[model samples]
Target chain A: MISVRGVHKSFGGVHAVRGVTFEVGKGQVVGLLGANGAGKTTTIRMITGFLPPDTGSVAVAGHDTLRHSLAARAAVGYLPESAPAYSEMSVDGFLSFRGTLYGMRRRDRRNATERVLGLCDLHEVRRRRVGHLSKGFRQRVGLAAAMLHDPPVLILDEPSNGLDPKQIGQARRLIRELARDRTVLVSSHILPEVEQTCDRVIIMARGQIRVDADPKELLGSLREASPYIVEARGDAAESVLRAVPGVERVEVTSRPALDFDGTAWHTFRITAAAGAIDLREPIAATCAARGILIRELRREAPGLERVFLSLIEADEEGLPSPPGRGRWPADGRDGGGSPGGAAPQSHGAAA
Target chain B: MIPAASAIAVREYRSLFRVPVGWIVIALYLFLTGVVFVSSALIPGEPASLRYVFGISGWLLLPVMPAVSMRLFAEEFRSGTAEPLMTSPVSDASIVAGKYLGACLFLLTMLAPTLIYAVILAAVSDPAPDPGPILAGYLSLVLLGMLYLAVGTLVSSLTANQTLAFLGTFLFLLIALLLTGDMAARLPGNIGAILIRLGLSTRMEDFARGVIDTAHVVFFLSVSAWFLLLAFVAVESRRWR
Candidate 1:
């Protein structure tokens, strides 16, 4: 339902989006995943007809955004960044005004207003002024306003931006439900939110599309040196973990500040050799045969963050990243190094 | 187009009441106009005409209308609501028209309460006030208000800073009024004659004396349209950059 061909946009000297190209088919839930300033919002704005590309064209539902902007805009609903809505107006009043702008009849405006109010779970605050609501509620109010017209295409920029955790869950459910019959394109800097909600993820970095694939395909491409995160109650666990056949390196990540049970538990991050087979079983069998207690032994699952990070790292440091994996770090640097050992927490992420 | 413009107009008009700035502007304008009515026209043997109030009210609009219009686009852009609005399926003209008309309607409301001056004079004066000049005086103020607001709307569209929009509009109107009202009297015949015809304060005289001049009316409306057109172009320019 949306096609962008060689789109380039610049603001004075800063090139916001450069030579970006992608197409989103009908009924697909796609996420433009990126860090801040990755040109996701710029791309969405061009598609919504709020902006015109400097060198290329964006078409929505077969309507060129530059040549037939009104029709292109008419087919899509957009929620801009920060979820801006007129704070002076009530939710019901704002949604009705939105309907009127779309040329809906009085009865149709009322019905649509009611429908979106319910869809976004905003009926309780429908009569209150938008400025009087909390940030999460106001964000939902913006979402409600965008989908008010029931357009076939929905383009939301950071839709979960200001919502609380519960509200984010509700919004994810709503976006999934809405994408059942429409082409939905959402952008976010949150990695798991994209992984959890999007059917296909297009990871962008520095105004370029670095990676685009399904979540599973991204995970399946992790053939680099996979790490085994081990937590046990012993000092010898490190050497025991390193003694496994597939083990190449083992580093102690953390030790407890105080031990209530006489001995401190140490956390070990074990990097497996390339093309290792079922290291979890081998590590567990080795630890069990040696009489070293194994409190936890699990292989790290590759996440979109890993793929996303490596790609962005390649962009920054001229290194080869793996969606097709062969090489590890060229200098034997730490795989998950983020300066203070706060990195590798995503190993705790539920993939 | 009509529906979209009217919808935006109605929203703008009502929005002026929702914030403290809108109420403060209306209050200040009516208070100033009331003081003028009481001090000059309400006196016992003052010809029972609305000349004094209407004359100063035109000047009052120089400051007053900009306050009403400065937020028309600037506030939207500041709060980021312009994204949803400009991206909607409405044309640029309707958005500009709606905002301008909304401010005009506000000026009309602020002036409406002053109509009691006519009834007051009619009750007390031996000969009631001349209805023609009274009606003409109002027409003059309305046109002047519309013209000033168009200028304010154009200034508001150029930037997202309300204070800058307000100051830019006030200074521009002040310069225009000064050139046509003061400088026109000092210059030589040809330029002076042209300035006199173009001067809003001078043209208001024809209205106060109960003469409806078409050239003066057209000048006010056309210049207003020209400014609004500039505003529409300014609004459309946002898409390119």
Candidate 2:
């Protein structure tokens, strides 16, 4: 439903987005992730036809954003980052105004306004001025305005910004409901929100797409490559762990962290073999059975944060963007960090 | 195009009444025109006509119309509401036309009460005021309003600051309508002849005398159109920047 090709945007001398290319298919809810000044909002703005890309093009619902901006804009329902609205207008008044911009008839406009008001849970505050509402309510009103026309494509930048925890959960559910038949592209700084709500996450760094893959793919890849940290005092720990079923290899990472009561306390990193069960339970049981002093055994949970940081760090070091499955440990070894040398280096054609 | 422009126009017009600034500008304008009405139009032994009222109102609009138009685009930019507006399917021309029409509606509202002064003039005078000059005077007022509001609209589109828009417009009007009239008399030749004709105040004099000169009417409309066209270009240029 949306295609951005070779899009480059510059503000004065700063290149906000450079040679960025991505596509969001119909019915796909894609989350855009990035840190401050990472070009997420800039990219969203270009796609919404609010600003023309300095080079290249953005097309929405088969209409070019620059060439047929009106048609392109008509296909898109955009919620800008801060969700701005006229403070003087009532909630219903604002949505009705949006209806006019979309060219809906009077009756249709009233119905759409009523529908969005109910959907956003804005019935009680419908008659209140928008400026008089709380920040979270204002944000919902902005979302309602975007949905008022019932456009096929939605490009919301930071939709969950000011909501409370419960409201954020409600917004997540609302977004999922809205994306049932529509294309959605959301950009936000909140990682877990994106991880839970988006099917696919695209991570951008320094004006480029560094990682683009399914959320599960990224997490699974990182989990397969990550190693667990074990801090304990045990006899023959390395050979003992390697002999355990489902254990791939074990290595002593550092000298004794402490010498407490005449015994050295050391740290080891344990790696599990490919398709092996989680090693935490098995490792602990084995240590207990053998009378080894077990202090800590914890696997690095490979969530979206690990993958996001890895791609960004790799980007800083001048590595190309991924077919990020390349970051997985194809050799079945643990790399154990977001920017492990092997993960980004192996990145090429592997998906 | 018509629907979108008209919708925006309605919003803009009604919004003027929604906030205190809108009512404040309207009241201030009526107050200034009322003062002009009492001091100039109601004097005994003077000709019972709106000629003086129309004349001073031209100068009155020098600052008043800018106040009406200063917020037209500047406030949208200031509050960041321009995002939803500019991103909508509406064209830049429609946006400009809508705002222009809205401000014109406001100008009409401000002028509506002044008509009562005319009724009083006709009733109180032994020789009723000639309706010809009264109608023509109003025609001049309307023409001058079109040009003045158009200037305000054009200036407002260029900046995000309301004060700058108002000051810029006030300065431009001062030079084009007032100073040019005085300058045209001293400077001789084709340049002087052109300045006199182009002087907005000079043209108002013909209309106040109950002469609806087609040249003056065309001049007011064409200049206003020219200003509005520039405003359209200014608005469209934002995306590129």
Candidate 3:
């Protein structure tokens, strides 16, 4: 339903979106994920024909955004980032006006307004001025306006930004419902919301797409590449743990027992080699033979947060990796002290 | 395309009456025009007519027209409603034409109540006022309002600040109104004569004298169309940035 090709946009001397390309199919809900200044909004503006891209083109349902803007815009239902509306107008008045702009006839406009009002659950406050409503209600008003024309493509930028939990849930459900027959592209900085709502995820960083994959597949591949964690306590536990087979490196987490109090415990996190055999039993057996007490031993399952952070970190470091192996390069694998590397280790217990 | 423009025109016209500023501008205009009519035009010995009333209202529109047109595009930009508006299927020319028409309609409403004064003049005069001059005078007022509103609409499209739009439009109309006659008289050769002939106020005098020259009508319409075109260009320039 939407095709963007090598779209590049710059403001003044700064490039906001550079050579970004992606396609969204019909009935697909794609989540655009990025931190601040990632060009998500810029890319969206280009697609919506609100801002023209400097170089490449954006087409919606075969209508070029720049060449045939009216037809392309007619196909798009855009909800801008802040969901701005005419504050002096009532909800019904605003919707009716939108319908008129879309060239709907009077009877059709009235029916569409009533349909959207009920669909967005805005019937109760339909008569109230939009400025007098709360943020959630105002968001619904924007959604209602966007849906008023029944456009085939919906582009919403951060639709769940300031809403409460319940409202966010409602927005997610509404988006899901809208995506049942239309193409929906939703951009958000909230990772979990995207994970829960999108069928496919596209991660952007510094005006480029860093990673694009299915949410489950991305997480699953990252989990398969994750390292193992083994904590042991006793005299010389670090050396014993490091001596085991298939152990790549062992980094001790804390200072060893001092003053001979016999109460101090030492922990070591282990990173095993690719295709290495199960090191958990081997490490346990070694610890037992060495009179070391095993405190904890487990393999960490990488979650979406870790995958996202790793992709961003890799992008920032200018080391673009193949989709799955980008998390930790072989040579740069220090035991877990790297920035964003500690998240997976700490969250390992929960997984 | 006409339907789209008309839809926007209808909305703009309805919104004019929905707000207090529209009513306030109309009331203030009628009050000032009524005062000017009673003090200057309604004399005991002089012949009863709407000559002074139409002229004074034309001058009054120098300020009143901007008040009505200042918010035409400035408010939309300031409130961020321009995104929804521009993203819609309507073309820039249609939007500009619709808004200009709406402002012109409001100006007509402001001029409508002054007709009562014309009625009173015809009723009380011993020799009834000539209907020809009265019709011409009203036509001149409509043309003058259209030109002013078009200029104001162009200025509004240039800025997001309503105050700036108002002041800019006021200064522009002031220069257009003040510069042509006095400054044109001082210039040398045919340029001076042509400039004086182009003076808006000078052209308006013929209409009050009940002479509807095609040249004057063409001038008013061409100027209004020029400003509306400029507004359309100003709006379409957003796509480049």
Candidate topping TM-score: 1
TM per model?
A: 0.90, 0.88, 0.87
Computed on C-alphas against the true complex, the DockQ of each candidate is: 0.84, 0.76, 0.63
Predictions ranked by DockQ, top down? Answer: 1, 2, 3
- Candidate 1, residue A53: the lDDT equals 96
* CA lDDT of every candidate: 0.84, 0.83, 0.82
Model 2 Cα lDDT, one tens digit per residue, B1-241: 8898988888889888998877887788788878888888888998787888888877787788888888899888888888899999999999999999999898888888888889988888868998988888887777788888898999999888999999999998888764568888788788888887667766677788888889988988998999999999999998888
How well is each residue in B118-139 modelled by candidate 3, as lDDT tens digits? Answer: 8888888879899988999999
Q: How well docked is model 2, in DockQ terms? A: 0.76
Question: Which runs of model 3 end up more than 4 angstroms from their true locations?
Answer: A227-351
For residues A196-235, could you state the per-residue lDDT of candidate 1 as single tens digits?
A: 8998887776676656666654555463445788887677
Give lDDT tens digits, candidate 2, residues A117-179.
Answer: 988999999999999999999999999999999999998889998999999999999999999
Candidate 2, pairs of clashing residues: A310-A338
lDDT of candidate 1? 0.84
Cα deviation of B173 in candidate 2 (Å)?
1.9
CAPRI-style docking class of model 2 based on DockQ: medium
Q: How many backbone collisions does model 2 have?
A: 1
Task: List, in the given order, the native-contact fraction of each candidate.
Answer: 0.90, 0.81, 0.66
